[model samples]
Target: MRNKLILSVASLAAAVSLTACGASTTGSTSSAASSAASGEVAVVKVGANPVPHAKVLEYIDENLAKDAGIDLEITEFDDYQTPNIALSEGSIDANYYMHEPFFNDQVKTKGYKFEHGAGVHIEPYAAFSESYKTAEEIPEGATIAITNDPGNQPRALKMLETAGLLQNIEDDSAALTLTDEQNPKKLKFEENQPEILVQVAKDPKVDLAIINGNYILQAGMSTKDAVIVESTEDNPYANFLAWRTGEQTDATKKLDELLHSDEVKKFIEETWPNGDVIPAA
Candidate 1:
């Protein structure tokens, strides 16, 4: 079922109150805005992560898409795999959560016929823990929670490697299959969906949780609370809007244009002043 998105600050506030704070679904599977003149709006159903992806699209839906005669139906997903699956199976017109490398990995592994739009935003990953105040304060045998999705798993591991939590960083971008010797602290890693990275961070039992910046923002928190954050300097993981190969719909096209617009850029810059979510070049 498609849920319609109306134009208002209240709608945006609703999204922030829910997904920004780690609630599972937002606004009940939203439908794309439709054209009244033609008697039916082109519903470009898009799947995205809840925090910034859906919020950005909602901004476009309210401010930009109405003028462009484009309607965006945003479907929210938690994990990395399902959005691509929904896009591939014709459940949605496009998606806006992952970057080039993650998308390429999905295509190569699952052979999903998908292509990307313009670069949207960069949400760096970080290590957040309620167990320890500092990185050194973390006790041995601490339980760590990371995203289980193959696309984001390496990112979590890479962040850990950079924090000196894991040594002998032979391949930071490869599959995470570390031996006992590879991890010095002998920390127990608990794999989870990317959407719950923040949830894990909130768990008192878990020592540490590696969460994405967008979710952290949704949780009414910032990367400043994290022990270690992934560097944004020439970061390769630039999130973008994507659709099926050679099948960019008119609504998707307008959305792509509006996403790179000045208003959206300004919104991102002002919303995340601490460089949690940076607009991609």
Candidate 2:
């Protein structure tokens, strides 16, 4: 009888060990189910210029993304070329620095398989000066600085034309190039990258500098202080978000929606109240 009692006790201990293992397994499965039911947040990585593009994204990330069931990871890019390159290489899921013209040019020249959403905002191209307050104050044969990129050169030239600095421009297309005759003022054109145009503007020798609107904000320069500011009416240069073809997910669509929402428009208006950045219609 004692021997029988010993075997029964051993069997009871084995049953207890098995019961504990089963409970652990059941608890782990329950936890996994709970997680699956809650769903994971989608992450959308974006590359953008610092001033307004990233700033706008930052606003959306901080205020709107969580409710949309997604998260934004923004990578700031200072130059124009790298953002598109990063998008092409899958380093970033999307980019938001280029206007439609620039975006078209990139796809045409580099053959990037990219697609874009509607215009988000317009950073009006403006001309600035350290030596002169008005466009007319610029002297004849003045050395005016402009961007060297073909995509944006037309815009700078167009602004110059609006200032009556350039004339006889027959070809108004994106392929337009400034000729000696088009420059009626005999103004000398100094072509540089867009980012450095602000520094060129500060230079005493450079008579005028036509800078991008985003750069103006980045440099703490106000559009109200510009000698010439592009009109926002029917402007075609509104910047938008871009992504590789067929790579856009639901999260990216949600981001694009947030960018155009009324709340975003209010944020932009309040942030740059002087019209430095205008929400695209």
Candidate 3:
């Protein structure tokens, strides 16, 4: 009877232990299932400028991101330089404010291992003046304020060449610094930070100011208001999405697709009906 009691007690203990093990396995399986469900959503952090870049991303986050199983985290940068820095530093997953030339220059000069998607839109670089109503009215020897950045300086010079404001303009690469011979009008070029070109445009002393389209919009000025606007046809300055090379995920690709979607195109059209910003071809 003593042996029987001991055997029965041991059997009961074994049964309890087995039950506890089963419960633990079940709990783990349930938790894993929950985690798998949550993993379907991907969070993508992007840096952009305020005017159109952040606004466009804001539209996607509010309207489309949830359905695509993406959560867009947008950081707005007031300056042009910081977005790429943030992207390179891993502070942001991607950026959307730079055009092809600027992107290429940043990658080349800074050695950022970056890759870009198709052009999403074009903000035509434009020239604004407080004193002149038309490009033809820009006087000889006038002081024109332009961006000092290498990528955009060439663009501004090319536009001036097109307007017949400057002569003997070299190719984009060589036009960084103009010689006295290139200056038929003897126009003095005042190089300033791109963001402040709007103030230069507003200054009565400055004869002309060529400003980036994004900055134009931020200052509540329209491309239509400019005396001279860069042509959109065969334009190579379309801004697009960019990310670190080999680090691009499905979420970033989805965001790029969304940026070129019909809905986004329509949003840009209706938002800037005067052709301040055009969808890239």
- The TM-score obtained by model 2 is 0.83
Candidate 3 TM-score, C-alpha based: 0.84
Candidate 3 residue lDDT tens string, 120-195:
9999899988789987898888989988788888888988888888876654633336777787777888888888
Best model number under lDDT? 3
* Per-model RMSD to reference: 7.5, 18.0, 18.0
Task: Report clash pairs, candidate 3.
Answer: none
Candidate 1 stretches with Cα past 4 Å from truth are: 1-42, 170-176, 179-181, 202-204
Backbone clashes (count) for model 3: 0
Local lDDT at 200 for model 1: 74
**Candidate 1 structure quality by residue, lDDT tens digits, 1-281:** 23322222224444434433333322212333233335445566777777788888888887777777766677676556666666665657788988876887789888988888768789888888876877777777889888766667777777777777776655334334687766878878888766677777778889999887667876777888788889887887889988888877556777788899999999888877888899988
Maximum-TM-score candidate: 3
As a whole number from 0 to 100, the lDDT of residue 136 in candidate 3 is 85
Worst 10 residues of 2 by lDDT: 1-10
